[model samples]
Target: MKKDKPKYRQIIDAAVIVIAENGYHQAQVSKIAKQAGVADGTIYLYFKNKEDILISVFSEKMSVFVENLKVIIQESITAQEMLARMIEGHFKVLSEDHHLAVVTQLELRQSNKDLRLKINHILKEYLDLLDDILQRGIQAGEFIEDMDLRLVRQVIFGTVDEVSTTWVMKDQKYDLVEMAPRVHEILLKGIQTQ
Candidate 1:
């Protein structure tokens, strides 16, 4: 598979920077190829076009992202702790990569309807992990008994997402990762069973 080749990752990584700096519509295949240190035609070997590259970037990065969260979740004994670690990990990862933050928080969200649909499909893995955590929390009495799992998942995910987007939009003026504990505390209080 093309993904198995070194250039594939090189191209994908390059595409991230290029798209983040140029925006998807302006991110040319030649620019990506140059960033990847390959020929323009080589991009076609790994992707159909700019749109495919964007989707692949989300797919590849999100797969690894969800796996890392699963590991962090497993390390915690309670759902609350797991959620905290998940928040920390999410914020830490994005903060460490400003370009990725910009791309995920802004650039990716600007894609066309069809592309957004595909991006949402890739996002399901991350959302499902959040749902699983909410289920575990309710089961363990860490959360309310009558909670709506779907709505709570959205709230949790949406809160973190909006916070990160705000940080990106504000030019990451403060410590985004440092906000994790506060976010965790606020979210915990909201869902914790009395």
Candidate 2:
């Protein structure tokens, strides 16, 4: 029987799992196709190559993540509250999906310089969301006026990224969501108004 959803998405999802489990270097297209329960040729029909699949996965997942975060943050009345929720949402999503967490924190980073650059482009959407919050906070006097928005964005993203990576590397024994409050607190020190 034919599936209603597009075959490409299935293949990509399968690729996520395979890549997460086996690492990027070991995740052959054939393995991804098999995991998706489709033929090897089926993968090519959707993606140009293995790299295309990886890039597409990051782009698609990050796009959805940023879009959702934007809506949530818009509904928030305060920049601090919005920043808290964004961090919570990010850690929650990454923590809930082990495969995705592994793919994002570990496997995806194993790509060469070119692929890494492409992934960085995909990451801009999420980075922009953080930057928007920083800008708003600066304007509202909630955060310091002299704060470097770009550097602040990097610190926020990097801190959360490192925290999540450590959790994943530790086999995720602790609750990632519990760290959100502390993460927000530490970040606030640098940005908050005295």
Output the number of the lDDT-best candidate. Answer: 1
Writing each residue's lDDT as its tens digit, candidate 1 over 66-149 gives: 998899778889999889989988998889888888899999989899999999999998999988888889899999989888
Question: Candidates' lDDT values, in order?
Answer: 0.91, 0.88
lDDT of 2: 0.88
Q: Candidate 2, residue 73: CA error in Å? A: 1.9
Residues 1-194 of candidate 2 have per-residue lDDT tens digits of 22235787788789889999989888999999999999999887778899999998898778767987898777999899989999899999888889999999988878999999999999988888888888888888899998878888889999999999999999999999999999999988888999
> Clash number for every model?
0, 0
Q: What does the lDDT read for residue 55 in candidate 2?
A: 95
Instruction: Go through the candidates in order and give the C-alpha RMSD of each one to the true structure.
Output: 0.8, 2.4
On TM-score, the leading prediction is: 1
What are the runs in model 2 whose C-alpha is more than 4 Å off?
1-5
Which segments of candidate 1 are over 4 A away from where they belong? none
- Candidate 1, residue 47: Cα displacement in angstroms equals 0.3
